[model samples]
Target: MARRTGLPAVEVLDACESTNDEALRRARAGAPHGAAVAAVRQTLGRGRRGHVWVSPPGGLYLSVVLRPGVARECLRAVPVAAGLGALDACRALGAKAPRLKWPNDIVVLGPDGVRKLGGILVELCLGQRSAGAAGDAAVCGIGVNLTRPRGDGIRPKAVRDGMPAPLPAAYLDECGAPAAAGDYAAAATLFRDAIVRRVDAWAAGLWKDASAAPLAPVLEEYRSSLLGLGGTVLAVTPEGTVVGQGTFLSVDGTGRAVLALAGGGTLSLAPEQASLRPLAR
Candidate 1:
């Protein structure tokens, strides 16, 4: 049996289209905060910008419903908090120096290079507003590759322009977490606990005085473990347009990517606005 955390309810399924989809459906139906849905495999798994997430049976797919009636500015930090939570879980499970890729990706550095271990997606479902509060429910979805799929099994399919090419997928098993494999329920529970724990703290801080500044500690923690700080990178929009190319700096108070442009200007992009990619020197 999996140990319970702050979650109110947990549903484990053999397979689902996507845990985020199911969790959103429940949230709309008035499911209370802290409800979680996890599946062994996802048929229609998706990442940010509707990119397909290859969800094999060996991975952990989970989504948690959060109803933190804070303002939009505070809500923007959800991904940052969730990313830190995922990083903590990875570290707790013995993966060394797993760093957060801005906005959503959790990656591990290896001898060859950086390889992705998992990713997060946060989707908001707005609720009726009353009494000067922002009524919103966010489903924080996370996916971690615990073991390499068989042939195309656990290996992640990399994005290719016009040809078929796949990169070697990073696995928790290979990163000193062999214990996470062969146990879907336990792994999902651990992920939910770790992620929700940070979100809980973030929400509490925002609710206290209705200010985002108090949550600066969370932002700094994220900044410390952020991958590619000081590296040249491109902020690409979902349409594949280059929004900005600059040196990576720390994220701002509201969790926006701050960059130092070459032309003596700065750019700050929201998580929903663009995806960051490394610019090869």
Candidate 2:
């Protein structure tokens, strides 16, 4: 663990079950905001909707504990702001044109196809107090494959359009990004600073009762950098059920995925409601 000015504390572990889990434990014990945890490898890394995240060595795995002073409704925008921060870190690490997959994924277009570069998982946890109380926090976990793992290669499984699809992972090193573990720790610091700025901007808007006005700038930049916008997509639940299929529109102010349905209606899905998959036109 190392302490840097303005960063508070960043605990880098040689190995852990999950950085998110570790950070959540610290948050429950009253760790202040901006506290972060990172690991060289995770034996039990997981993502949204109970999906497993293969956290081999040479990957950037980090989680930051956040305690933003905002109402419950305003929490929905946290992931949106965090995603932008992750995107900023990716670009800083030299990943060219990384597109944010709706909800919490960072991917890039390659000759093989659109492969994943990294992903984010935001989990809300109770603080030292009970639910709906003053003490509550969220863990924003970020995982980026910095270099190719030594093995048969990472072909992680995912659900796409009501079926299980195997994803061939993409590494940042493939795009000329830095791969040293020390660089990864620096990236984690970058992510923390980036997310804090965005969250503060959003909280200011909400405090003034300016509905969507504060998020306007964040949403604008997010939508433009989003992948597969204006293309066909399917929103599927974790149970492999197709909830909706439509043209992918912009992610709205509150971070809902706005889809233009095939039957002349629009559908808005929260991050937990579904995982989006692109479809061929």
Candidate 3:
């Protein structure tokens, strides 16, 4: 009996090229804050780093527009906080507890292995807006596999280079849960509502907190949920250039990954700067 009565009106849609793009368009057109657009499928869904997302029917693909009035320095906290919100939405379905990967991935851990359940993509457009628009707004796009995906090779059956690749499934299977409620549609509704609730909450913090104190709670949650902290990892650039091997430290306040190189020195990596892969312990 999950409710969709949360703030930020959720608009259901049949299809979209990309929810984030559509949401951003609405924002520019003076859409109210928290206005969300969700599609059953996306024709051109993309994740952070512009990785193509294998979006098909039966998954939760959504985006929302918001004006989180935080300073430029504090903007990174908004998406990092979004990781927690997505995690909460998955947990709402009584699925296996998923962990947060630095930057913004929600993944489920199991004896079989870790499978990524979903991701959060946050985009900002500060000054460029139509006349008479709200403060700086961000479009947060979310995608959760609620059932098997179409035959897309991006999400392979096995983890790649020790980093688990994305896969598709209902939240129950997606999170390694053995069983779940019978109603798939109802469950999808609940998950969507849960995610929006978390998003609205985080956006509120960005609007009110000056020093980004609102992210304190999110960072705390991330610590408990973060996957590879204190483990060995190899960093690589988006172009696939190897950065270095290091012990995964923690995500810093600016949403950068802090890596302690094996030989010496520490490096902080932004999402655009690197992707991390776990090394076999």
Off-target runs (Cα >4 Å) in candidate 3 are 1-8, 128-134, 150-171, 174-193, 199-209, 212-214
User: Which residue pairs in candidate 3 have backbone atoms (N, alpha carbon, C) closer than 3 angstroms, thus clashing?
Assistant: 146-170
lDDT of 3 by residue, 168-249 (tens): 3234454554332344445545554555566567656565665665455466667778887899988877666778899998
Ranking by TM-score: 1, 2, 3
User: Which one wins on lDDT?
Assistant: 1
- Per-candidate TM vs. native? 0.89, 0.88, 0.82
Q: Report the poorest 10 consecutive residues by lDDT, candidate 3.
A: 159-168
Q: Could you tell me which residue pairs clash in candidate 2? A: none
Kindly list the per-residue Cα lDDT of model 2 for residues 146-242, writing each as its tens digit: 8888875443554232234644678887876754335666766776777766666766667767455435647788888888899998888767778
Q: What do the candidate models score in CA lDDT, each in turn? A: 0.78, 0.76, 0.67
lDDT of 1 at 105: 86
Worst 10-residue stretch by lDDT in candidate 2? 154-163
Q: What shift in Å separates residue 126 of candidate 2 from its native position after superposition?
A: 3.2
